[model samples]
Target: MSVDVFTFGLNHTSAPLSVRERVAVPGELLRPALDALRSTWGAAVREAAILSTCNRTEIYCAAEPQVVDQLPAWMAQFHKLESTSLQPHVYRYQQNDAVRHAFRVASGLDSMVLGEPQILGQMKDAVRAANEAGALGTLLHQLFQRTFSVAKEVRSQTAIGANSVSMAAAAVRLAERVFGDLDQANVLFIGAGEMIELCATHFAAAHPRGMMVANRTVERADLLASRFSATTMKLSQLPERLADFDVVVSCTASSLPILGLGMVERASRLRRHRPMVMVDLAVPRDIETEVGRLDDVYLYTVDDLGRMVQTGTDARRAAVVQAEAIIETRVQNFMHWMQKREIVPAIMEMHEASEKVQQAELERARRMLARGVAPEQVLEQLAYGLTQKFMHGPLSALNRSEAGEREQLLELMPQLLPRTERRR
Candidate 1:
């Protein structure tokens, strides 16, 4: 049986942060999660690759119908959730659907912020992790290679990424709405994750008065801070220094809010109600929602940023159309390659049949020559034998037919046989 490429999982689109965070695989646990998936779904999946980012967790697999069909149950078991809880939030794609999904994801169309280029690097990292865990195979490897190529081609050929707003840019835009001029503000970035790094880059362009990176690991914070000529602080010191910076943008993998209402309230009192603009980009938001109610604190969650990011999507709808057109063309190109792959079995079968016929004829001819049959006679017998096998069906059909069918065969044979000999 032939196995088709399959993909299933939830993302920012299908599941809320509540459900998504429960199953979210951290980078450090990716190998273990992949190992668990392999052990649990071994029979169903021939090969597997997983990509789990802040916005999505998707599994790509090569498997049969049974394996593909049972994937949801396996996922539920693996994540230790009720099947119903996971099933509604999951979307499954098989064969070309899976291929197209992979391409679109790599191309950044499926991103929370459309056309963000960071996803490509994230996907590369996921693939590398899966490979390191010994979970990737030829199908997944090829799919990802083609996906990268499609992404590169789309980036080079279309204006999909051009003028697209990034989360970092959106974070800065929201902060500017709170604080008029960033040059007059001290900005604090919490965590040194990729999102924070990107946010720092955009904010640094504004030439903020001061920039500080506070991370759980001081080394990572220092590494990020040096790029912007900023200072680094430990996460524990955030409460003390929180009042010093006017703008705070935080996105971290913390299980709970890093900036609670109490902490912000204390900071607001210390700053003498100077009005702090804070954006919490994390899922389990870094800043508590109640902080928004504080007199001197302005807090925006990921949901708030989502609304801002969606506004400009309308303006870019035309460009999105153009991008979809480009994507469709590339999808068809990838599907064509997949289709050729599907027919390989039939092609191999035809080659094997032809080889069998040739070998049988050769063996008979060799025996004839060994028995002292004339060279020309041996060649004639071989040709007749090969021709008979090749034309057996049409000859048998013509002989069995009585009237009109025989006449049809007689007319079709000359046209069906090649006029020139097929080149060896």
Candidate 2:
């Protein structure tokens, strides 16, 4: 079966946080997950890459057409979820549609926060992971190279990213809405990854009374803290220290919740029920869902931040048409490249056949010359032999074909055969 571009999975728009979180693949498991995907279908999945972020988990593959239907099942099984429950939220895109979806995704046209630049970095990271896992082959490599190019073109040629609200900025806005003013609020950041760094930058601007970073790695936490002159603490210290901050932002890779109800409840009691704002930007959630019900705690997940960032998107929405036009042109070009690639095997076979014919004819010419045959007659025989060998297939097909097929062959013969000018 011919391999074609295929993309399958769900994102923030198609699935809610609860569903997305269930299937989210952590960074540490990316290589194993990729190996499992390719191993599950073997040759059916020729080339594969899994792009798993807090907002989406998509598998891009160069695979047989039949593999598309089975991909959702594989994803559900990989994540240990029931296929029936996950199938409805899944989407599949093939060939040109797959190419367009990738371009749009890299260009941030498909993000919850439209034109947000963070997703591009996240995609690059996914591609890097795929490369490290040896999951990337020619097709996916080309696709992603073009994807990056298209993203650059969209960002440079259009105003899609301008005046766009970032998730980090949105989180700060949400905090202010709850706390009235950030000047007196102490902020706690969980994790020292990119999202946390972005949130730290934005919250730093608020000039909060104090800022602290809690991470599993003290070195990473200290590194992030050094930049903002904030303090650093270990994750083990969170239960005792969680109530010190009025606002908390967490984005981590842990598969389970970092802050459970009991911990937050204890923190609330420590604070004497002071109102607190907490943002959980991790996929599986760094904070437990039940903790949101606490009377003194204002908890928000990545989805809530996404919705908050979407509010002022009208200004950036104007650039969507222009970005999409750019993506359409690029998508057509990529599909054309793929179409040309499909004919390569046929072209190779024809060349191989023609080479064999030339070799056979040349051998006959050499034998006649060695036998003391006239050079002119030998040349004539060689030409005739070459012509006959080249024309045999077409002539036989034309003779055997029925009326309609013969007529079609006759029409194609002119283009398929090289023209010969008569000697005067």
On TM-score, the candidate that comes out on top is: 2
lDDT of 2 by residue, 1-424 (tens): 8899999989998999999999999999999999998998899888888888988999999999999999888888888888788888999999999999999999999999899898899899999999999999999999999999999999999999998888899899999998878999999999999999999999999999999999999999999999999999989999899989999999999999999999999999999999999999999888999998999899999999888888878888889999999999999999999999989999999999999999999999999999999999999999999989888999999989999999999999999999889999
Candidate 1 residues 310-419, lDDT tens each? 66765555666666666677768777887888899889997898899999999999999999999999999999999999888677888899898888889989987757
Q: Could you tally the backbone clashes for each prediction?
A: 0, 0
RMSD of each: 4.1, 1.4
Instruction: Provide the overall lDDT of each model, using Cα atoms, as 2-decimal numbers.
Output: 0.83, 0.93
- Whole-model lDDT, model 2: 0.93
Candidate 2 residue spans exceeding 4 A from truth: 421-424
**Using Cα atoms with residue i matched to residue i, what is each candidate's TM-score against the true structure?**
0.85, 0.98
Winning candidate number (lDDT): 2
Model 1 TM-score, 2 decimals = 0.85
